[model samples]
Target: MFKYAWICKNPDLKGMARRAILQAMDTKPYSTWLEIDLGAIKNNIKQLKAMTGTRLMAVIKANAYGHGVLTVAKAAEQAGASWLGVARMEEALNLRAAGIKSEVMVLGYTSPVM
Candidate 1:
């Protein structure tokens, strides 16, 4: 299981650390980092688009299969994905909270109340 030492609720603070000893200008500054090749994603999308006339829907579930949800979703958008798909409301919420304007649909069962 994964555990985090801190979490911030204030959206105004981009890089705020809720309980870290030092504050930074980027959120998750001290968190584990991964490199996602958005260009590669864009290229893949272009290839897929070439083969299919059907509208493209980017499944961004499970953090884009560990490719990072926000980054992949943004790249997919730039690559002409017609819609973004998430497996849960939290995933959709995260995308929206990050300012993603793509059409998003939750693919999994969800509770009615927030």
Candidate 2:
């Protein structure tokens, strides 16, 4: 996997990039908002459990990789997720903002300046 270590080192830049990407898109801001289907995520987790019968963790970094982190984290929890992983503090904060009560692990480091 191509790790975004550079992004990890600079959160302000990451935020700017996110805003820029959103602004650059030739679509309405409302259209950029994504509605994640928690039920679908739960169903998929159930299916995976039935097939594998192993522990499952939800990777919810990068706004759930653009699927909305908190939404997906909630679904993953409802579907019996044993762990939740994120790539940055902001992503974890997003989950927290959504009132998701789950163990969120930040996969990378955050400078003290953060």
For residue 103, model 2's alpha carbon misses the true position, in angstroms, by 1.5
What TM-score, over all chains together, does every model reach?
0.64, 0.58
Lowest summed lDDT window (length 10), candidate 2: 1-10
What local lDDT does model 2 show for residue 76? 94
| lDDT value, residue 62 of candidate 1 | 99
Candidate 1 segments whose C-alpha is farther than 4 A from its true place: 1-35
Candidate 2 structure quality by residue, lDDT tens digits, 15-101: 887666666764655635556678888999889888999987788787778776666787899999877899888877877787888
**Model 1 whole-model lDDT (C-alpha atoms):** 0.83
Residue 108 CA displacement from its true place in model 2, Å: 2.2
